[model samples]
Target: MFSPTSFDSRRRTLVSWLLPVALAGACSLAWGQSASDWPTKSVRLISPYPTGGAPDAMARVLADKLSKKWGKPVVVDNRPGGNGFIAIDAFKRGAKDGHDLIQLDSVHLAAYPYMFKKLPYDPAKDFQVIAPIFKSFMYFVVPTNSKYQTIGDVIADAKANPGKLDYGSWSIGNPVHLGMEELAQIAGLKLQHVLFKETTQLYTSVANGDLPFTMGTAGTAGPLIKAGKLRPIAVAAPYRLPAFPDVPTVAESGGPKAPYEVSGWNVVAGPKELNAAIREKIRADVAEAMAGADVKERFINFGYESLALDRKQLADFITSESARHENIIRRAKIELD
Candidate 1:
């Protein structure tokens, strides 16, 4: 029973079990230590929008604050184009140490799945959304010289001349397009959608009275509105925005009373390989940066309302938005290759 061979066999089995456990513990400790000391070098914040837009501005602001806090250089890399695929692809190929982060919008995370049949990146597997940066409501804008005074007038005219009243948006399957489609379906109106290559062209058409109306942000459409070229009939929000207090809500302007709101939002995301501790660290650091006075003022100037959602809450919000977009896309019958 106490033979040397039997004793050696028992010792070998114990060593086999203990060795793996010890190695696992060492690996876990390493991960924790690395996470705690994340951003060992410069960080890259990749943005899908060009340098002038609100998202780009937000990215710069975030980068500055995070850089100061982490004592590392945080740079914003703009790789805009291909409907944000360029920036996403770049992020996928970038570092996985949580130093390479991305700025994604509601469309990229929530609506793209329902809109496209094939995508280069997988929303669930390729990335992790950490927190929401901001949320902005789209304003229903018409020409200043337009005869339509309220959303009710637009609806009535659409009903009177079915398929004659037209609206414009930059692209298909965008928030403005889907939101207007939802509005048409709900109001039982036959309307035509005119597509433009850019916001300036779309708003220019609206101001010239070639297009009846289109949904736009205050930042994108504010200059024309200030120049008396475009008049905001209503905003797709429950309450009036502080920047445009005179503008009425959709319900106030005689749209559906069921709170027909359409808003676009942006969030911070990173590669999925980032550990939980690193993600939380970034989330916490971002929250702190957003709370700064300078960041708050900058967001307001960009017509963006800051969001204070944590990781789980952001994920849930994205899921709910996806479901909402799915319903809208199904009813609107929108699909892309």
Candidate 2:
């Protein structure tokens, strides 16, 4: 017969060991079930822009297709304003089960971190990159009848006039604003920045000759250029855009070829704590969705190039872009006011 104290100690040891084994088995089972039963309910995709913006349009299209593919409802929640902070806040506070997705852009991911001294979220720790949906080629546009016919001409004029030449963008701290500043920095010139509250107003001002020129994504400027209201002087991309092959790239148009390309991008991201398996699944699904015929056609029509990079590649791109934009922000002295 065992002593009473020895018997109690043996029982406690056995219970502790058994409890851990049981818990591990239960957790494994739950993870497997979650992976298998994902999309049993609706998935919410949050767009940081207003309902009519390009990001909103892309999210809606993707949500519809994803809904059909997964056999569940896919809803797009538009929470515009606050420089994308509003949407990001909502996403951070939402469920961490991979049921909620957020659409992010370069400003939110790359520029904001450097522009603001005190950011509310950390890009590396607060969110994970799911997939890169699309990348739009940026173009330097001026009035169709403006004196500047090429990128070289703009650079020359800026060198001569210094701060007299002014460019307009939709807002401060946007890619358009930063890209132009980068161009000026590279070309060794100076120019004034004019901020507009609305995109339509910005383009209209450019078309009507209120401003000399502006940098804009091809998707927004394509229609205007095709309609003969604006002229594409140069494409600020790694290579010439297929849609505007006749137009020369920044390198080809006699601008400094120091890899000064910038564009508006759409990406899928989730809360930082999302399960790895769920995150990968969403990333794969987005890649497939972007490759679909309808999705490809829509992107082509809008003058956007499909990126469709996997999780690792997307993460690498974001990291590199963050570094690149941080340097630009520091050199340009851009602030979020």
Candidate 3:
């Protein structure tokens, strides 16, 4: 007599044994050609950020390095705008064969679904997240002479004078904007949201004290800080930045437990139907490019931490990061229409 419990256990045991075999077969089937046969033509690297920015610079570096490695032209196509939708749309339409790849910010893959009422492309279905290139931490910056000296001071002032304080960023729902929104909720601040059309004017406004606060990466703000034009009120990170050891994290800088500690990250991915083998090859190539001394130096200058995670590590990292953003969106009560 076969008990129901025994039958279910037997089924579970069978699946556990067959799952790996099936996965291996699928991988082999997708890996139809040798590495030399792959990348048979020129590759297009689509970028969401405009030219002359950190993302564009990094994309070009990887393109040049990969082009040399593959013996083909690797071109960077800049389609920056619409909160990265422009480039993502181009990638979906351009590369059915998986040769064309796009650089994506983790925020786009994780936060946009909850930030907007409708997204044009489904993050999980429209692309395959090959691997992460690097991560960047944000800093809470104020004018050098501002009365506010710490992140806690800014929050208290906002509370003391509700809706009187304002912060600036280039776009809506970007990590810069969303991080501030989350911070306000955590610190119970009533502040005004300010938008700018370009980063140049935005940082300049902060330098001139037109805005009370803004978030900037080290590459973006470090020069100004070193020039004695801007002061870092606090860093929105888990630990103190090694470059600026004198500065403190949000909590260390006297703010309430912050909701904006997760650093921003960028990834290289391709069309969802990209061959498993090809995807794996691209991931490996990109990792090697990142490991070069010159590549690391450029990223350092841009205030990025190179991740270069292996396949298993990459999968686990993306999954954990997505879950963190989902929790933040839910807690912040952020829903766009």
Candidate 4:
């Protein structure tokens, strides 16, 4: 046992095991440091919406705040069109160090999976959804001088004259269309859907009495509503919004008694392999950024309600929203190419 050759061989065996462990510990330490010093360079916040829209405004405000916080440039790269695929694909191919993030809406995360037969991106695989930035409720908008006074009037008319009452939205599977269809299904009434190319055309048609009604947001239909061209019969929210205190909720207006609500929201998402520490840091920083007076004012101007949900709560919200969209899509037989 005291032989020099035997002692040398034992020492060599111990060195092999210790070397790997030493290297692993060093790597872990370096990775931790890298995470702590995240955004080692400039960060890019990608947006699917074009400039001047609410989503772009949101991205820009966050970029400004985060840039100041990290002492590095945080630029918003707008890659609008292709139903948000352009921005998503760009993000997927962009920096792998988590310096690039994407802003996604409820349609991309909740409705599209069921609407599209083969989606370009996988929600569960491609994204690490962080948290919701804001949510805005849609109102049941009608012409001001119309015969209907409340949502119940519309429902009763639909029941009395099945398939006569119709609604409009910009697209087939948008929240407005889906929510209205869900309401019709719940109340056992037949209603028709009218499609428009954009919100202006949709709401204008409603104002002109060409379209009976359509779901609209304050930001989109506020001008007409304020001009006394369109009337908001009810808002699809659990409770009344502070800005519109007089408006009743969908339930209060004799909608489904089973608690129905329709809203559109935006959330920031990162690459699937984003580091955990950096992710948490970004979430916390975003929350702080949103709490600022400037961001709050922007939200108010956009008619958006700030959502301060944690990661788990956001995940659950997405799941529930996806399920709700699936139910309506299946019932309404809506499938897009």
Best by lDDT: 1
C-alpha TM-score for every candidate? 0.89, 0.88, 0.86, 0.87
lDDT of 1 by residue, 1-337 (tens): 1233533343343333223212222221124445567779999999999998877888888999999989899999999888899999999999877889999878887777666767788764577677678888889999998998999999999999999988988787888988988899899998898888888899999999988898988888877998899999998988888768899998999898755788899888877666666766788899999888887787656667778776546655665676677677777777788
Ranking by lDDT: 1, 4, 2, 3
For 135-222, candidate 3 gives per-residue lDDT tens digits of 8888888988999899878888888998899899887667787787777767787767788998777788898999988999887777
| Candidate 1 lDDT trough over 10 residues, lowest sum | 20-29
lDDT of 2: 0.77
Please report how far candidate 4 places residue 127 from its true position, in Å. 0.5
lDDT tens readout by residue for model 2, 1-337: 2233533343343333223212222221133435556876899998888997666788898898889878889999999988888989898888777788899887887777667656677664567666788888789999999999888999999999998999998777888888888888888889999988888889989999999999887668777888999999999888877778888888888887857797878888876666666665677787888899988888767778989665446655665676677667777777553
Score each candidate by Cα lDDT. 0.79, 0.77, 0.76, 0.78
Model 2, 276: alpha-carbon shift in Å? 1.3
Q: Report the C-alpha displacement of residue 310, candidate 1, in angstroms.
A: 2.2
Q: Report the C-alpha displacement of residue 93, candidate 3, in angstroms.
A: 0.9
User: For model 4, what is the error of residue 260's alpha carbon versus the real structure, in angstroms, after optimal superposition?
Assistant: 0.3
Candidate 4 segments whose C-alpha is farther than 4 A from its true place: 1-33
Instruction: Note the residue pairs that clash in candidate 2.
Output: none
